[model samples]
Target: MNMSTKPENKFSEYLGNDEQGNMRLRLGTKFAAIYVEKGKDIYKETSKGLVKVTLEELVSKPWIRENFERERAFQRSKALAVGLQSSHIPLRERRAYKKRMGWVGAH
Candidate 1:
């Protein structure tokens, strides 16, 4: 897996571009993610067969990003609390908290 494109640790979105209409994914973004809980195996069998998947997979047309929008969103969230905090608040709250935290581009 490419080190830069890999998820923070684990956990992925399994998504694709909105217009591509990838039947295998759910996200409108080009980036994707995959992860299992701290316990239990990440893989399980289903009608789709052995269910072989990985965190390295990009389900979209492959955003091919270097400091792409996904990273921008990540940075913006990091600059915000609701976005990066464990509280799971909405985007607005996160943005406000970012401003409070003095993140320059939080808006």
Candidate 2:
């Protein structure tokens, strides 16, 4: 990419937990409302329905956070490896990609 030239893509993304493991938070996209799981509750009932904790928290108790981290790291690398040009992906595609990438969307 060019150092001075701005990317045709409107925004970039990443995966990470907040200080309290909230959400990555975005703007003007489906993920704009995305959120990360937080708390020890394996499941919770929301207005939509019951939500289950991710595998990371589920296995973290018995084993180590390292296992989950490795899996997540691998997933991140896989997504990046696709080498999909963010700008070429188009807006609708980006929205759909994000929606598929996370489960935080309101049903």
TM-score each candidate.
0.20, 0.24
Residue-by-residue lDDT tens digits, candidate 1, 21-55: 31122222343332222122232235564354344
Give the alpha carbon lDDT tens digit for every residue of 1-107 in model 2: 64433333423233455586543322223323222334533343346755665787557643223334454577678777676554477768778877888853735
Candidate 2, which ten residues in sequence have the lowest lDDT sum?
Answer: 25-34
lDDT of 2 at 107: 59
Off by over 4 Å in 1: 1-87, 105-107
lDDT of 2: 0.47
How many backbone collisions does model 1 have? 4
Error of 1 at 95 (Å): 0.2
- Backbone collision count in every prediction? 4, 0
